[model samples]
Target: MTQVKKHEAKLSRAVESIQPSGIRRFFDMASSMENIISLGVGEPDFTTPWSVREASIHSLESGRTSYTANAGLIELREAISDYMEERFDVSYRPEDEVIVTVGASEGIDIALRSVVDPGDDVLIVEPCFVSYAPLVSMAGGQPIPVPTFMKDDFQVTLETLQEKITPKTKAIMLSFPNNPTGGVMGREDLEKLRDFIIEHDLVVLSDEIYAELSYDQEHVSTAAIDGLKERTILISGFSKSFAMTGWRVGYVCAPAAYAAAMLKIHQYAMMCASTMAQYAALEALTNGRQEMEEMITSYRQRRNFFVKSLREAGLSCHTPGGAFYAFPSIKASGLSSEQFAEQLLLEQHVAVVPGHVFGEGGEGHIRCSYAASMAQLEEAVDRIAVFMNTIKKEG
Candidate 1:
């Protein structure tokens, strides 16, 4: 008698092929060690504003503990619509063009799934958020990296974008006031991209999660560009800007058709964003501006101090224009990005993410978040300086 064969369960190829987030891996490693000063994650260090938290508490006390509409709370959608228009001059019909998401992350996932078909190519500006390429792959699209450089202020150029475009290219994902590098695109930089995107007929998935944190210049929405609004899927949330990371509230604004497509997916996968969270988000939009602005001011000060400190510590760093990160080149240390980060963490108890994990154009550099307190930033830099000196002595 033949023995019965044992069945082995298998994950879908899509899920199986994806790697865990590099940012989380380092953060976890650092968490296990004592006295580790982690600059790995890109979360704000501030607590959620009092009014926003109070709104959520009130909702809970009022027994409003239920799921919202699949498209989210109409009140929150209207608030998001107003906030977008007033702040960025981009308007969307709240009724059908805005969908609140579990997070900006979910908005990105649904947006990619809504537009991408198998084998389609999505151009991602490199040294960007770690999730973009993986999300594209999960959506059955090919993620093609378009490298941006520090010399170019990490802004994608028409020429660079053209080099990566193919007939199969379906969309381009952009994040201004970018993560990791903290590079921001000015109007001129975006205008150069506009003609190229129009020529290629590409959908634009513009991740503006860090828009409100921009310094030196105003954050320009890609949808605010003259001809790009119709094709741009704007994804942002209260997490970064309002220090509401734990609140898990974000939203996507797009053309009615695109919004509907994403909403259908959101309906099946996630019935709605949390009811309490939506109330919190509404309060955030209504009255959280002053506190948000104060946080932005603090981040700008941290950026200046951290960038200066990194440079004085002997790393060549491009002063980031937005976000609370400084990507400093570690090439002079005769070490790869991973090596430098590892040695720095092990020796000095300071944890930063290695740049190469952020994809092309990230090698030989390290991403240090300045979202910690000033005292922590000061101590981290001193430790970094000591680490750099040890490398010099060893060399």
Candidate 2:
């Protein structure tokens, strides 16, 4: 009898084309080391607010463990609706236009799958969250990188959008305060984007997860801009602002039609967000505002101190207006972003993400998250200073 020859399993082209997350690669490297001060992952060092955790505990005690409706608990949706309107000036009917997702990450995934037919183009403004482009590719959409620069504070302009737009451009994914760069768009800046979206008839997938973390100005919701609401799919979550990363609760707010489309995909894929997490999120919105504000205040302070420290260390870091990251140019060290990050981790034992992982216009920079404690930040800066001096001497 002839033995059967085994062959390699053929992975889908979409999966094969995507690279693994650069953030996680660095994180795993750091995890294996001893005495490492990690400024890589963007999670808050603070614990989830006590009241929010208590709500989840009470939920478990009360035995509300069953799955919720695919759209989520109406009570949570209603609270989210009110929160969005009060906080960001965006309103939606909770009954039909809101969906509770596993995380804002899930909201993004479904939003792309719901709208992107194969070969459609989705304009992603970069340097951005690492997930954006990969998610687009997984949905069989062309991920068009519309590169933003330090000269422009990494905010996308109409000119940049115009250069990337094509007839097949179906949507534009935006994240502000952005992940790696920590850039944000003000109301006037968003109006310019609004006009372009309208002219091109593109859907807007606005990831406003960092909305409440804004330090300098109010986070103007893209959907709040005139004539853009009808086409915008707003994604946000409790992860950043509420310190609920492990809880995995987030939401999507969109026009009725878009929400319905995303809901169908969510129902089959996720069913609903965690029942306990939904309860916790509701409590967070209702009674956890003060704690959230205090966390934001702490982050703002950290951002200021960290940015100044990076500059003094001889790295040119733009002051990030929101989010807890500092995208400092590491070019002065005469090293690529990856080389700087790797050497810094190996020698100084401080971990940061290389900016090229965030896509176009991201090289020559490194992303350092300031979500660690002040003590950790101080020590990391000292180590970075030493690393800079050593590299300079060698150069």
Candidate 3:
């Protein structure tokens, strides 16, 4: 056999089965081209808040570079517990119910691995953060993508949940203030799932990394919902809200039973999250609220201006209620989501993620991040307008 074939055969079948993230393909493509205005990255453009960074510096200067407890520093976990209860009405015990992770991404993997048995079905709400389905697959679970719609503002409904459930179903993964779609579920909207959650007795994995970035309304924690605390594994991180993408810190708050299960895998595989990053997170909890608010205020303004520009350019878009993206329908340009994004990159020097990379429901749409500077956003909008007009003329 050929050497390439032999190497392929040596790879894990599970790893081979899953597809690489499509988001990075366009990101890499944009990186190769000069003068590309990219709205493709989903992270905040702001730097990590100063106090948070200073805390990390202080830790380093103090020689606090050793590994933390497998479950993380006691103080950081306590701060997380207190912060959740104070801000969102959700409570977890730092001693046994909260575990610091490498990022929310690691929290997700450990949580799924903790609960899922081989051949179990995990329901994923779409359009979601790109990693959810792949993580489920890697955990030996079947990922059942239960799609939400733009018409519904991408909120998962009880009816849709009902259609997908079966005896093999083991859990449901949720992301909101959702990535790509920028959709948030209100308390009333989330209340609709309470009964189904009770009846099925299913585990719920809630990824709420963008919780603090919701515009106009407070984010509703699914864990805050009655009957879900015991069943829900809540994952969030410093990356988006604190602009600490490089910190590689996040956390999970779950019932003690689930936490214990996840902790075993975490202790063996990850050992611990970065020690300095945990110290920085503790500082963020203690004193970084104002800085976060300032960043949010800037994002709110950019979102309004960018979404308005998209609508005016004749792409139908729903004003995102949360997160930093504006997903606009590009169907009018007679282009598939990939075609529109690629052609726009080539013709207008603009980089946006083709919506289908997010999920099946993302077809005919493209996700443009408003996380860039207002000047860049305005230029991107102008470029998108020119591309749209050029396509219309061609048609």
Candidate 4:
């Protein structure tokens, strides 16, 4: 018998079938290049507020290193409950309705896994955060894409929602103050989705991680809507508003049944969020309000300035009302989104993510983060203008 050649162990089909993140490719490439200004990552540039940092350090100094409850420390949960009620008029019992997670990212994953069964279709609003579809797939559910148009400011309409619903459609996922596009759904728009969800007996997973980053208007929570509280699982965290990205703290609020189900998964897989991060998050909720306000004010100014700069450079970009990114159409540059981004990075050393990575509706656009400093934003725009003019001239 011929000797069998050895090979590496096979990976799971579920893991292998999914494509690698499109954002990471450019981000990694930019990292290796000197003087490359990256607009690819969607993270706040601000340091975590000093008060919050001090709280975490103090916790470590006082020996708070051990895990808390699987649902997280009761104190932190109570703070989250009160904060939500005060800010958004949404109520939750800290004991049973809320669970702390590693981050809003984990909260989303568990929420989807808890509610979605095999063969069920999860309707995802795109171009959304890239994780939504992949997480739905990993949960043994079908990932159904629901595209929103740039012409409509990327808001999800009842018509668009209705057209995509199938008998298998079980739940809907949404993120606003959305990533990449920075589109925010107005209260009227969410009311439309609310009616549709109730009529169809569907559940909702609303990711409000960027809730505090809204520029033009106050952020609205779907759970506050009449008849929506029982059906919505709201996910948010300290990452965006408090600039606590590495702190990895987030919370999920759901009805008792759903919360219990998610907690089951959390107890086994996660056990608890970081104890120090929880203390830090407590500090953020209690005393970091003024710091958050100042940061939002700065982001608003950057949004206005950078958007004006893009339009002046001849890129047709919608003025985003929230989030740190601007999705500008690059169709007029006579290049695909990928081409525009790749060539710009190679030539201009200003890195941005191509829009197609966001999903089907993202073609012909690129997502540029305004999270960089004013000086960097100014230089990036200048380089982008030069690149655009070159592309136009060549065309």
True-structure RMSD, every candidate? 1.1, 1.0, 2.2, 1.3
Distance (Å) between predicted and true CA of 186, model 4?
1.6
Predictions in order: lDDT? 0.93, 0.93, 0.93, 0.92
Candidate 1 clashing pairs, residues 3+ apart or interchain: none
What would the per-residue lDDT of candidate 1 be over residues 1-395, giving only the tens digit for each residue? Answer: 99999999878998899989777777777888999888887899999999999999999999999878899999999999999999999999999999999999999999999999999999999998999999999899999999988888788888888899999999999998998899999887898888899998999999999999899999999999999999999999999999999889899999999999999999999999999999999999999999999999999999899999989999999989888889999999999998899889889999999999999689988999999999999999999999999999989
Instruction: Report the number of backbone clashes for model 2.
Output: 0
Give per-residue lDDT, candidate 4, residue 181: 94
Off by over 4 Å in 1: 1-4
lDDT of 4 by residue, 157-269 (tens): 78888899999999999889888899998787788777789988899999999998998888899888889989999999999999999999999999999999999999999
State how far residue 373 of model 4 sits from its true place (Å). Answer: 0.3
TM-score of 1: 0.98
lDDT string, candidate 2, 1-395, tens digits: 99999998999988998888888878888999999999998888989999999999999999999999999999999999999989888899999999999999999999999999999999999999989998999999999999998888989988988999999999999999999899999999998777779889999999999999999998899988999999999999999999999999999999999999999999999899999999999999999999999999999999999999999999998899999999999888889989999999999999999999999589999999999999999999999999989988887
Tell me the tens digit of each residue's lDDT in model 3 across 1-395. 65664443478889998899998888888889999899998888898888899999999999999999999999999999999999899999999999999999999999999999999999999988888889888899999989988889888988899999999999999999999899999998888998898798899999999999999899999999978888999999889988988899999999999999999999999999999999999999899989899999999999999989998998999988999999999989999999999999998999999999888989999999999999999999999988888988999
- Please, what's the RMSD in Å of model 3? 2.2
List the candidates' TM-scores in order.
0.98, 0.98, 0.97, 0.98
Q: In model 4, what are the clashing residue pairs, if there are any? A: none
